[model samples]
Target chain A: MTKTSTKPAPIRRDWIAKSLAGTLLGFTLAMGCSGLLILATAGLSPGTRAQFAMWLVTPIWLGVLSGCFFFSSGLRAWLWLGGANLLVFATLLLARPA
Target chain B: MRSDYIRIYKTVHTWTGILTGMALFIAFYAGALTVFKEPLARWAAAPVAALEVPLAETPALIAKTLAAHPGAAKGFQLNLKPTEDEPARLSWVEREEGQDDHDTLSGHHYSATLDAEGNALVSESQPSQLAEFIDILHRVVGLPFDTDPNRWLMGVVAALYALALVSGVIVLLPTLVKDFFALRLGKNLKRMWLDAHNVVGIISLPFHIVMAITAVVFAYHDGLYALQDKFLHNGRLANAFNQQRPAAKPAPRDPADMLPPVTLLERAQALSPGFEPSSLQYVNLAGPRAMVRVWGTDPAALAPRAMGGFVALDPWSGKVLSRDFLPGTQDAANTTLSSFFALHFATFGGTPVRWMYFLLALAGAWLFYSGNLLWIESRRKKQRQGEALPGQRLDTRLLASATVGVCIGCIAGISLTIAAAKWLHGHVADLNAWHWYVYYGVFFASLAWAFWRGAGRAVVPLLWLAALSTCSIPLTTLLAWAVPGLGMWANTSLAALGVDATALAGGFALMWAARATARRVRLGAEDSVWSARKILPSCQGLS
Candidate 1:
């Protein structure tokens, strides 16, 4: 009698990895849209623009914030990105015209 | 600590949803419609003259009325110049305190317009009936007979809405990332419902939060007034509260002997630079106290709340006394408030925003209904298998009834009341009373019907009724046009063709729902009644 091998299906690592990647992309898009809105509406000065640029990329600093919710091997990278973004927004809010 | 917090929030969300879901549904739905209040008003007052009267006309009209009936000129308001599709309406209220006889007229109230000779024109083109009714629905849920309890009750409901929103977010947090775009269809009712509820909730998260917060703010404005009195006013609650209160007694002003209305307008405009006059108010006509107050909008402003400015002018001297322009701080606050309104009304950026909000609002309404379905689907098998305790079955039924009653009830009530407005327009003794009668009458009738007919059967019929009522918007217009006094072609007509067009689009949607429901019923679906059919089959398979 031939024994039919019963093994657990693979974890579909690619799909999970893609989902994580997609989430990061979505986060980026959302941040980009928010930045565009600020530029279009906030009437920022040249100095303010430089400050905002630094803040815009700060989402990467809060890498821990993203991994706190989801379980992924690429969590550390997301955390770093998120941590950076938080730092950027904080700086922008604190920025004053010189 | 985190887990415990999440649990507490979950409980809060569930209880809040249970408590305020019905009221919030009505408020949000009615409010969404109210964003187009002007358009609705125009629709209600169809066939009116597309008059673009000068802002100066209001004071002139007020002067004419005061001259004609001097005793009736206690306090008057300029109805403002109507847009290209509306007629300017002028109205004044006269109050007589301490009248001896019960039958004695408290005060004379008169509204009139100017003729080609600038004489008083007596025509009854009151505010739009439908718009007023919708406003009432939005404000008080049409419960005039029980105002005190209703306000308090609605206030509680608003509080509960905040709780629900917070809890809903908490519940969503765990799966938000994995299921951000996950809309799984087919046979697992619980999963399907969860997906629907989550998708809608998350997609419209910003809108839902705004609605909840604003609803609480609006419904509990009385509380805010109290707070302002307590904290900001240094214990002078009454005085603080009264500051924002609209001027009640129209101070009798001595009308100037003779003054050029255009001059007053020009002076008022000059006082408020870059502001276009929206309305002009003349007080105490023919008396020395006669004054022209010009209300205008600032064009360069981003916020509509801060956009309005006021200039009060002395008709005789054309001297501007008060110029209330939006201050910087006030403008910022007003801008925030205005954004909230813009978000709520979908009028911030104009047409595209309005359409987006409309679709999202409808989706929100769907989310509320589907959330209840998810709860039921999760619990249904237990009841069917006899595994649920005795009270569980009753609980299930009650929830079912409530879900059906509130959702379908609101829809049918709004539709019937709107339709009835046309039927009862000129015949009713009091237009306002008739509006209330129709609204409450339909509401009660719907509640009773929901209870009598099982939720399953009631769903399709109520959907059809709602669809039919929405569909009737265009038909009502056509009927108005066909009827001699009610047609839209007349320059003085109050209804707008845009409203009719909206109704036609709404009708198509209703037809689509009816078809979907019929298909579900044919498929022998469980819980096909209160749940939307498009997602039902997939939900069933999941179960």
Candidate 2:
């Protein structure tokens, strides 16, 4: 009854792929999310907002990475996460004071 | 949600727990006790030396200490109304300037106390680091081939731990509200364990999440702080990784200009009404940035950072530089974040909350242990069609031995070493070094014994050892008092008394566990390795 869903073949391959995606893509998403939070609270005191931004960094990163497991396949998880990460990163790039 | 995803997540959860369960158990258990580090340190202190000074007397002590050890004039912390365990202690780090290498040689920590004659008397006695050593085991586990600092490996573990939490929640969500709380405690031991595990786990989900996030930050906060300095302060990310957070440093103050310790406490108290001063941190005493930060506990606040409140005072002018984190002074966002830290470290709701965290931590440890046992039970392979083999599979035996060795051994090692703190105090050359020797000695011995005698034979004896070592903490304390002239406050100070009483209770509990396990091994399950009766007769094919 217990040995049902987790087949052995694809697991050896996909786990590594999923881990890499979580590290790279999840970090990108986390960085973007934190930046966006800082920008959103740009009106607050700089120190306060910055501390708040610092506080959000870990949860957002871990959250994004953990959310990756819900996807049907490792490749799909990678693709969707990568796309969202890019969208956020690009938005931050354009919105920056450069 | 698809059923396949549940299976996948269950796989994820199981593997993650298997990989990280042992370390997390150590961390939670030790972390629970770390909250009471002050009390333990106090209990370990020699009765004669456990004296505290009032704030009014600190200025004199500081003056005499400065006059005696000129190095401390540069910087030192004048500890004030600290916890009962620590009293009016002053400390400083010895910085060796002008080393050949770029990094300043920073070691030689000095903690001094003033004598009755106002002479600067530095304490040469060593602390057992009993609490700290456990904390290190929690934080680092000192696992092989991980990382040099071990904190980075801890961060990676924290990340995996976070993933485990997420997956566990999802996997249990479907029937979480229905059967998660149902305790079917009849014949099905596995069912009972599963119910208890899920119930405790889900109840503490928020606490676990806070630990995961804060652990990640603590593991790599310096780098993260540097990252912020890079991104926000018109700095480069390339330079950030190599640099520390920039300090708002100014020149140090002259010796004559340094303010009195009581004045700093008064200023802190004035800034935050009803603030009970804990300690005073004097920084850059020889430079322009010479400021004394008075830390305290507010009667009305629960901010994290453990100390609860802070007020920085200028050494020269004795003027308040910045004041926040007190009961009335904290800004909203900072206050909110501090509460999260408070939750992470169990700093809220005082002693009651601490006791709750302590129970929860032990429960958390049990969850992991029972999970391992369940795995071993489930994976026992069959020798014939529909017939079970009495001997456990190789994998089960290996895991069983490791689980008992690592978990029970850790319990024994920490307990005995802590118990040794009193006897080894003045007799030992280095009291702190003896702590390491005692812990490693017992730890490896237990491990070797477990692997040598096999799980069924070793469990009872190892547990008895644990019970003996743990109970000895209180026994030693009471024993000292039994000698007429050797009375120390063995029965006073509820916190100190509580520690000993709790240890004694834990010892009794372990004894009960040992007896129960022995019973289980002797009479239950005819084919199981847990039954020594079965294992003894079926030993021909086994190693």
Candidate 3:
């Protein structure tokens, strides 16, 4: 990691689009993550599992939202988050209780 | 973090804060007052004649009261220690038909006691809703009602607030170590404001984080439960919580056969020596699953709910049914879960913790207020030494007016309404409705006055108004004692007197603020929106 004189590329701030991406996609991602949690904790009592699932959504959603700006562009954010959402939801569907 | 990431986070923090600052200001301010909701209710409750029913006689009273008012069989309370707010031995509330379950203020309250002849003396009562109303304002960000839509709006604000907090921390990360404790007080006003904001924000970061997360959960818990039911519990979430189901065709039980109040209290205290029983709530007393919840607080452990934890028991058999919510008796998992609620409600550390939360909440409110001030100050168009000052931006002026209006308006409105609880009790036909009117009237009038007169001219008078309104709280108590013919009553309890003392301090603080703000408007920067020398274009020649 040698120091260089060249300036780093300017980050594009498409705030509105990125905000929409974070809000809409971040929620689905939270649901998917919590869904996976529900599947993993299926052996726990129904009440406990339900409590865990319900309380888990806000923190996950906020985490994704807070990290969304790290992506260089809104489209990149949407793409990466959309891909992660698909993977998690697919895993959740396959592993859900019968 | 890269400079660009920091810059991005700064923007995120700014936008999120500007969007939710005013609403959060109201929430935190009202929430500070709500920490003492019980005391406020006690102070506002009209003194009633003593109706002390003996503990041994409660069985007969319950039997007769149930015979006369079968509606209370579904749920009712036996007040073990009746305060001014709950003056009778037996009390219950019946919700109006089709009323929302969350709307506690609109319920029909009833209380019962054994008469001299052993007959149940039942009466309808209207408890003062001043405390409940402020709690509602805190919950729904100053909304008049706690409806689904309002709660969802609160959820959005809470979510944005969470984002603001995180991004604010990220933005301050570069200077975190250097400026952590800096409170540069001299001429650089922006530096001073930033330092103050950072001090409060960073010191209370964990508190704000918990509040933000818990507020979002509270706002959307019903919907969250629905999601959990759909996904995790196969629509049996409620059934899972209630392990025992009442028999569909079970025979009704006799209320008189239940264990006496003394036995119930003894049973509860046996489980935990520190548990102080305040009331016994009987749910489904006539049905097969008749249970009595011994509700109280334990100073040593965290309460699982705002009203404190309870031990549910079978009234007839004196068998403990559930100790999940019993504070000191909870298991590891239950204690861990209850800690969230306890931390949010300040129910773990007793009165000292409550006072700490009250002061922290007020500081949180000041954080928002100073954030807005920093915004306006940053946008100020400084005048050249030899030239006339450039006009401040329209957006900044408008924001200045709005900030003063909404923030000071809430302060003044809440203070005046609290005073109204004592003054307008019997004078108004519906005192609860008058609380709403008085609050919104002051709030909107202050807003209109600020926008009309501009922030500089309106701020001083509004602060004075806030001061006087808050001072009226103690003044009302004084008048009630001094002038007995004025139809006002006062409670001498420490809880009630504490309200007067706190309001007296708050009123004088507002006076000092008014004086300081006046000085700033007259002699501070003339190139700012808070300057008295700057006249609006429309009123340029009036003076």
State the lDDT at B496 in candidate 2.
76
The worst-scoring run of ten residues by lDDT in candidate 1 chain A lies at A58-67
Indicate which candidate wins on DockQ. Answer: 3
Tens-digit per-residue lDDT, B1-543, candidate 2: 767678878888888888888777767666766777667776776654445566666667777777778888777877664544454478776667754221222246676776777676776434346665665666665342223367788888888888888988888989888985687776666677678778877988887887888888778666665676666535543442322232766554346545677666677777768677777788666664566777766646775576566777776677766565564567776679778778876666777887887787788777678767767766755445344454568878877787888788888988888888877766778777777788888888998998887787788889999999999999988887786354333635777788898899999999999999988776655455465554343643442
Candidate 3 lDDT over residue span B226-328, tens digit each:
8767865678888878876765867766788889989989999999999988899999887777899999999988999988999999898899988989989
Superposed Cα deviation of residue B339, candidate 1 (Å): 4.7
- CA deviation > 4 Å runs, candidate 2: A1-13, B49-54, B82-89, B93-123, B142-148, B231-233, B236-252, B382-390, B484-492, B534-543
What local distance difference test score does each model get? 0.56, 0.71, 0.90
Model 3 Cα shift for residue A55 (angstroms): 0.9
TM-score, candidate number 2: 0.88
> How close is chain B to the truth by TM-score, in each candidate?
0.79, 0.87, 0.97
Clashes by residue pair, model 3: none
Best of the candidates, TM-score? 3
Report, to 2 decimal places, the DockQ of model 1.
0.02
* Candidate 2 C-alpha error for residue B151, in Å: 0.4
lDDT of 3 at A50: 71
What docking class should model 2 receive?
A: acceptable
Fnat of candidate 1 is 0.00
lDDT of 1 by residue, B201-234 (tens): 8877878767665554555445444443343233
Worst 10 residues of 3 chain A by lDDT: A1-10
